[model samples]
Target: MNEIIQLNILQFSLIYLLLILVLILMKKSKISQSKLLLLGTFRMSLQLVLAGFILTAIFENPHPLFTIAYVAAMVIFSITRILRKNPWLNSSFRWSVSLSLTLTGLFILGYFTQIVIGVSLFNPQYTIPLAGMIIGNAMTGITLALKTFHESLTSGRNRMETLLNLGASPKQILLPDVNRALETALLPTMNSMLGMGIIALPGMMTGQILSGTSPSTAILYQIAIMVAITAAVCLAVFCSLHFGYRSLYNQRNQLNLPR
Candidate 1:
C-alpha cells in the first residue's frame, strides 16, 4: 500500500474559511443554522482527527477482534447520537431505532464483506470504513424517519383519530403517514444512488481512484456500497416507523397529542 498523503494546515484553514463564509450567508438568508454549522465543523474535525489516530493504530496491529470492536463502537455511537438529538422520544422508541439500525447495518455489512467481497479474516481496511458508511447512512435515515413520523402524528392527530373512529385499525390509520415518512427518510439515499456517476462522483469511488485502484474495481465497490446503503436505510426507516407508532397512542389507542 502507498503512504497516505497529509493535508497541510493551510489547506484545512482555507476549507474552514469557506465554511464560515457559507454559514454567514446562510444566516443572512434567515436560515438560523449558524450554530449547527459551527457544531458540525467542530465535530467533523475532532472526529476525523481521533479516527485518524485510531485507524493508524489499528492498521499497525490489524487484528480481527479490534476491527470488529471498532465497527461495533461506530454503530453504537451513531445510534446514541440519533437518539440524543430527539430527546422528546421515549426510551423504548430510542432502543427500537438503535436495535433496528444495528441489526440491519451489521447484516448488510457482514454479508457484503464475507459473501461478496470475500475478504479473509474481515480485515480492518474493509470492515471499518464500510461499517462507518453503513452506520452513518442508517443513522441519517432513522433520524429523518423518527422526526417525520413524530411531526406527522402530532400534526395530523385529528385525521388519524378520525380514521380510527371509522373502524380503521392502528396499522391502517397510520399507513399513509408511515409510508410518507419512510419515503422522505429514504429520499437522500435514493437520490444519491440514482445520480451516482452523473451529478457527483461519490466520495468512496473518488477516494479509491485517487488511491490508484482500477476504475472498474472502484466502480464495483461503489455500486455495492450504494446498494447496501439503500437496503440499510430502507430497513432502518421502516423499523423506526413501525416501532415509533407505539409511542403515538395510549392504552385506549387514542392519539396522544403533544402538549
Candidate 2:
C-alpha cells in the first residue's frame, strides 16, 4: 500500500467547513444551545491539541513511570468528572464511587494490557491509548448508571417507601433500580457492539486503516479493543452499582438517600 497521505494545515482547516453547516442547521432550528456547541467544539480542539503535544513527548521518552502516572491521572480525572456531575452525594456513596472506579479501572487496565494484549503494563505506546479508552468508557458507564439509579429511585420513591413500610428489606426494594441502572449503563456499549463493522467502522478501526494498517490487522485490533472496552464497561458498572447501592442505606437497613 502507498504511504498514508498526510493532511497539511490548510487541508485540515477545510474540515472546519462542516461546522458552518452545523451552525446553519442550528440557526434554522432555533436551537438555543448553539453557543454551548461552539464552546464545546473549541474546548475539544484546544484539549486535543494539548494532548497531542503531551502524547508526542511521552511517546518519544517511553518510560514506565510516565505511563503509570498517565494512567493514574486518567483515573483521578474520571472520578473527578463523575463526582462533579453528581454534587449531591454522601460520604459512603462518594467512597463507593471512588473506590469502585479506581479499583475496577486499574484492574481492567492491567488485565487488558498484560493479559489480553500481551503488552507490558508500562508500555506507553499501548498502555496510554488503551488506558484512555478503557478508563473513559468506565467513567461513562458509571456516570450513566448513577444517573439512571438516581432517576429510578426518584420516580419510584413512593413505591419504595410503601415497600419499606411493609417490611421489605432495603435490598429487595432497591434491586430493581440497581438492575435498571446496569441495563441503562450497558445499553450504549451493547448497541455499539451490535452495529459495529456492518453499520459503521468504529473510530479506532477507522484510524488504524487510515494509518495504512492492513485491513485484517486493523479488524483484529478493533475486535480485541471493542471486547476489552465492553468488558471494562461491564465490570466497572457492575462493581459501582453493586457497592454503590449499599451506600444508600445504613447498617440498620434504613433508606437514606439524598433528597
Candidate 3:
C-alpha cells in the first residue's frame, strides 16, 4: 500500500482557487449569491475545523453516555433546521419530526456500527462518524420532505378546501401531496445508488479507497451504508410527514393551518 499524504496549510489553501472561479461565474452572470456563497463557504470551513477538535476530544474520552449526549445534540440541531424550514408547523409536528429523526437515526446508526462494523456502541471513531452520517442524511430527508409538503399544501389550498367542502377527509386531500413530498426527498438517494459505481463513487467509499483500504471492503461499506441511509431517510420522513399531515387538521377535523 502507498502512504497517504496529508496536505499542509499551503497545499490546502489552493482550494480557494475553485472558490475564486465560482465568484467569477457569479460576477459574469450577474448572479446575486456571491455574498451568501462566500459566507457559507467560510461557515462550512469553521464548522468542520471546530468539529475536528470536538471529535478528537470525544474520541479521547469515549464514554457511552457522552456519545449518546453528543448524538442527541446533533439530532436537536438537525430538527431545529427542519423547523426553521417549516416555521408554521405546530408544536406536535415539531416534536414528531424530532422523535422521527432520533428514532430512525439511532436505529440505523446502531445497526450499522454494531452489526455491520462490529464496533462497540461507544466506540467514538465508528459511532461518531456513523451517527454524523445518519443524522445528516435524516436531517436532509426531513427538511426536503417538509418543505415540499408545505409548498404543496400552500399552493393547493383552494383545491384542498374544495375537497374539504366535498366532505373529503384530510387523508384523501393530502395523500398525493405526502407521496410527492416523500418521493422528492428520496429521489436523490435513489439516483445516487443507481449511479454509485458506474458514474459516481460515493464519498465514504472513495475516502476509504484513497486511504488504502481494499476496493472490495470499501464497496461493501458503501453498499451497507447506502441501504442504511435509504431506510433511515424513508422511516424518518414518513414518521415526520405522517405526524405533520395530521397537524393540518384541527380538533373539529377541519383544515387548520396551525399558527
Candidate 4:
C-alpha cells in the first residue's frame, strides 16, 4: 500500500459533483426531493468531518470512560432518531423501543468487542466503530419492525378485535404481526448478505482494503461484522416487538391501540 493516497480539498470536492446527476434526474422527473438531497448531503459531510476529529482525539488518547460515553451518546441518538421516525407510537411503545435498543445494542456491542473481536472492551478505536455499526443496524432494524408492526396492526385492527372477542390470547392475536415485522426487519440484512461478494463491495471491506489490509483479512472482518450486525438486528427487533405489542393492552387484556 502506497501510504494511503490522500484526497486533497479540491479532489474531495469533486465527489459532490456526483450529486448533480441525482439532481438532474429529480428535476426531469419533477421530484421535489432536491432540497432533502442537498440537506442530507450537507449534514452527512458535516457530521462525518466532526466525527473524524473526535475519533482522532479518542484514538490518540484512548480511555474506557471516553469509549463508554461515546457508546451511550450513540444509544441516545439512536433512540431519538427512532422516536422521531415513529412519532405516532404511544408512550408505552416509546419506552419499549428505547429499552429494547439500549439493552440489545449494548449487549451485542459488549459481546462483539470482548469475545468475538477479542479486543479490549474499552478500546475506543475498535469499540467506537463497532458500536456504531452494531447500534446503527439495530436502530434501523427496530425502526422497520415498528413501522411494519404499526401498519399491520392498524390494517388488521378489526381482525384483532374479532380474535379477542373469540377469547384469543393477546399473544395468539399478535403473534402473526410480530413474526411479520421481524421478517421485514431482517430482510434487508439478509438480502445484503446474499449479495455480499457478487453484487457489492460493502463499506467495511472496501475501507479495510483501501487502508492496506489484506483482502483475505478484510473479508474475514467483513463476514464477522455482518453476522454480528444481523444478530443485533434480530435481537433488537424481537425485543421491541415482543414487549411493544403487549403495550397495546392493559391488565384486563383489552386492546387499546391508538386511534
Number of the predicted model whose lDDT against the real structure is largest: 4
Off by over 4 Å in 1: 1-39, 250-259
Q: Once superposed on the true structure, which residue ranges of model 4 sit more than 4 Å away at CA?
A: none
**Which 10-residue window in model 3 sums to the lowest lDDT?**
250-259
Q: How would you encode candidate 3's per-residue C-alpha lDDT over 160-184 as one tens digit per residue?
A: 9899899898788998999999999
Q: Which model is ahead, 1 or 2, in terms of lDDT?
A: 2
For model 2, give the RMSD to the true fold: 1.1
Tens-digit lDDT track of model 4 for 1-259: 5678888999999999999999999999999999999999999999999999999998899888999999999999999999999887888889999999999888888898889879888999888998999999999999999889889888999999999999998788989999999999999999999999889989989999998888999999899999999999999999988888888888898988765
Off-target runs (Cα >4 Å) in candidate 2 are: none
lDDT of 4: 0.91
Off by over 4 Å in 3: none
Model 2 lDDT tens row, 1-259:
6799999999998988999999999999999788998899899999999988988999999899888888889999999999999876677777888888888778877887799789898999888888889889989999999999888888889999899999999999998899989999999999999999999998988888898999899899888888888888888888888887888888898998777
Q: Candidates' lDDT values, in order?
A: 0.84, 0.88, 0.87, 0.91
Q: Clash totals for all models, in order?
A: 0, 0, 0, 0
Taking all chains together, each candidate's TM-score versus the true structure is 0.86, 0.97, 0.94, 0.97
lDDT at residue 8 of model 4 (Cα atoms)? 100
What are the clashing pairs of model 3?
none
